[model samples]
Target: MMIYLTLFLEFFKIGLFAIGGGLAAIPFIQELSKNYGWITQEQILDMIAVSESTPGPIGVNAATFAGNTTAGIFGGIIATIGVIAPSIIIILIIAHYFAKFSETSIVKSAFSGIRPAVTGLIATVGFEVARTTLLNMEKYNKATNNLLSILDIKAIILFCAIIYLLNKYKKHPILYLVAAAFVGVIFKY
Candidate 1:
């Protein structure tokens, strides 16, 4: 069907340009959510959470989840492949050329230029996620004047607590994730 084709192509393009990681793919996913009405901002946040908690990579998991929601099992398969195809192809190409030009200045310069751009993309996704997660966009939309009222105090407190714990212990991340989950359930967030 046309929907499946569109999903594949759209996610393929996302995979092609999402140079950093799953976080970097968030902007593309958000755009698709807007462009196709395939998902909501709230669903995007949920997808991020579910994807992070699951076994696989977040971007692939997101593509699969969205595709399944849109169509069905086949859509999930196609979208997952679409999002990873470019990475597979690019890795092959890079592997082929890397041995021959491992010391070339041009290649080094290309990677040097790419690293910061990837970092910027990842940072953009972080801001976007934070904006959605820590702010009450529904309240903001109803009345834009009261910025203070639009902040989600509980999420902010939990975020700060997690940061503090991470800084203090620097332990495994799963501990923090479990703690957050427990807090969310307890607070009914």
Candidate 2:
């Protein structure tokens, strides 16, 4: 009971402030792992992979995954609602008044400012994810001389292969996800 309420409130706060999109919510999710111990950094990485592969918004998927892991099925439901409620309410309000203020310079300026900030947030998330995925921090910290020992060679190779394939084929993203999952299972990365 108490857990459910906590999940709802925490996710609600995330949804309220995660301005850009699901990717924008990742820093908050990372903070949750650090602060609450509800999930681990590895689990957050898994959540991002699964969320990106599956349908639905990443933020909602993350909320569902976190809640389900923390509590149960009902917790996932509650958390999903909590994450989306703010967006729903805000959209409703904006829809009601946007037409009247659509031409206002203030509104335009606000959006112009928000765009760059959102880009920065997304870019930071991408860098963090890549760093976590490709580098072993434990190895880096422990290694006294060999700087290259920190690199996860197998993961880096796989990442490069995926990037090359993505550029070459330009097919639907799901194909790459499936291929990556297969490779991950086989390699145990």
Best by TM-score: 2
lDDT of each: 0.90, 0.89
User: In candidate 2, where is summed lDDT lowest over 10 consecutive residues?
Assistant: 137-146
For candidate 2, the per-residue lDDT at 17 reads: 97
Candidate 2 lDDT (Cα, whole model)?
A: 0.89
Tens-place lDDT per residue, model 2, 1-189, is 788888899999998999977989889989988888989899889989988978888889988988887778998899899899999999999987988886799998998999999999999999999999899878875437678988999999999998898899899998888888999999997
lDDT at position 164, candidate 1: 91
Q: Estimate each model's TM-score.
A: 0.59, 0.61
Candidate 1 wrongly placed segments (more than 4 Å): 1-59, 62-86, 141-144
**Residue runs of model 2 more than 4 Å from their true location after superposition:** 1-79, 141-143
Worst ten-residue run, lDDT, model 1?
Answer: 138-147
Candidate 1 lDDT over residue span 1-189, tens digit each = 999999999999999999867889999999999999998899889888999978888889999988887888999999999999999999999899898897799988998999999899999989999999999877765445877888999999999999998999998998888888898999999
- Give the lDDT of residue 106 in candidate 1: 93
Q: Give residue 76's error in model 1 in angstroms.
A: 7.1
